[model samples]
Target: MNSGISGYVIQRLLGTIPILIGVGIVTFVLVRVLPGDPAVFYVTGPVVTQEAVQAVREALGLDQPLYLQLFHYFGQILTGDLGRSLTTGQAVTVSLMQRLPASLELSIVAMTLAIALSIPLGIIAATRLGTWSDYAIRFAATVGVSLPASVLGILLILVFYYYVGFAPDPIGRLDPFVATPQSITGFLLIDSLLAGNLEAFRSAAAQVALPALTVALVVMGPILRITRSSMVDVLTSDYIRTCRAAGFNWWTTYVRYGLRNALLPVLTTVGLIIAYLIGANVVVEKLFAWPGVGAYSIDALLASDYAPVQGYMLLMTALFVVINTMVDVLSALVDPRVRAQ
Candidate 1:
């Protein structure tokens, strides 16, 4: 079984290379094809000239043939060079490394909230299929699924900002008044805790909570619904009935027998949710002014910064692939039939 799993993992990792190349090609072409030139976007003042635009294009290697440009870009990436940002002229990899942790921390918190809330709610809903609790859970999940993220974000902002007055300003990851902690992981919350700065940690948490919650609320609904449905099916299986008939208590039958089987499907959905959350962070990040890769991608798009945009797309694609592969492996482990096949 270990060998089989290892082989499977190796195969998936090998497959990712071609997938990443395809993603790079598609993203490169799409960004290039988009209306407006990056050079012109950067040059806005009276000092802008045709020569300046050409110089910008040359600096970006936009003057090369399409295929040659892609080859050069790929070569640079292979050597651990992500190139300079068009807007800042700083190294793209460095910029991403600096900003990625804040987004990752937020995503972790949001996904943790989503899984913690969804699984139990789903299980309860499924267990009490015809009860008021079930109905209430269903209604809540429906509302979560139906509401747009933008509206949800606005509502959260209003309630927290106006009603509570404890909300932090929607600008970057930390307040300007507070000094940022030393960059260990680049995650303010973790760094603050590590550095023993309680105030910094509190500030980080306050700033992150709204955006994270906004993302969680939007993502939690589908996970809840899917988990409920899967749990319901598992509960109806013969093993569960047999367990009940064998005089096992309701809790044991439901939790041990039913939940283990139910979790296979839920795990699959959760993996997808994680992937979607990574991509969907764009709007939440923007609304809250969180410095994440999603926001970086948006800024790159607005400025037509192809390198950063391409890098972002490639990173997201890689993440999705890795997550999906993990889900597949986990599912195989949970379901013996997959390994048997």
Candidate 2:
């Protein structure tokens, strides 16, 4: 994938359009089919009259024909105007933006932790080959992959927060008593640092530790497996063998040749992991009470709040397209086989 990033990215972007549109259409249709209409839900309980229901439906524009509603929804998408939340009356755009930063911050930390730990473990497993250490690493990865994310999060909370009393409460992003740092990038850590508030940064970082560790454990398994497999294959390749035969410096040979060549598949896995973190961290988010987009989407989905769910899905789809395109470009740059194609 180490060829030309720009050209590959452009090609991928072009290919991604149809896929995004298809996803948007599917989400729009699927959300509408789910039980519990916003209008119906809001108009429930005693004295539930047809007029009241009709008024609520009219207010939410649910009375419009399906085609006309979809056409308008697509227009909103084109104009970057996600509709207002039917339940909360807040603009979907505003809510998503406000909550998005927290999700991004959590995901970035989780993946960073995963990559840091998983890569070395993977490298060790590959280098150790048939040793007991390698078998132990494989076993750990299998267990990690097997545990559901929520259970992993609960375990972390029990061990660190409840038993050890080291981790912060799983109430939300910050402790109940800690004053919030001034918002800069909306990332609490970076913003606190920028504001020269070490205390704030530390407070925010502590709150995320348990949840981030949970996500890291879940993500590390696949990444570890892939990295080890890639490194194993690369180490056995002719160039690597030549380098070893030539008696090149050990670390240099490993980093410059072995690691670089193995990054293509790793990069692909990383991109998918990041996207998964973005959209599929709902269970973890719930366990930790993290104020993330996934939690917001879950709340909306429960009430059949169409706009937020649709907007959330659309945003995730666009994100996958953009992030994966970048990954494809990187892969093309790293592997000449990809570049040649």
The prediction achieving the highest lDDT against the true structure is: 2
At residue 162, candidate 1 shows an lDDT of 72
Which residue pairs does candidate 2 place in steric collision?
Answer: 1-331, 1-332, 1-333, 1-334, 1-335, 2-332, 2-333, 2-334, 3-333
Over the stretch 1-341, how does candidate 1's per-residue lDDT look in tens digits?
59989899999989999998899899978999999988787766788899989987897678889999989989988987877787878888888887778778888899998888988899899989999999999999999889988899999999988788879887878888988888888889989999998889999988988888888888899899988999899988899889988999977898788888888778888888887677778888899888899999899889888888888888888889898999989889998887676
User: In candidate 2, what are the lDDT values of residues 87-156, reduced to their tens digit?
Assistant: 7889999999999999999999999999999998988899889999999999999999999997888888
Per-candidate count of clashing residue pairs (backbone under 3 Å): 0, 9
**Residue 232 of model 1, lDDT score:** 92
Which parts of model 1 are misplaced by more than 4 Å? 43-47
Query: Candidate 1, residue 149: CA error in Å?
Result: 1.2
RMSD to truth, every model: 1.9, 2.1
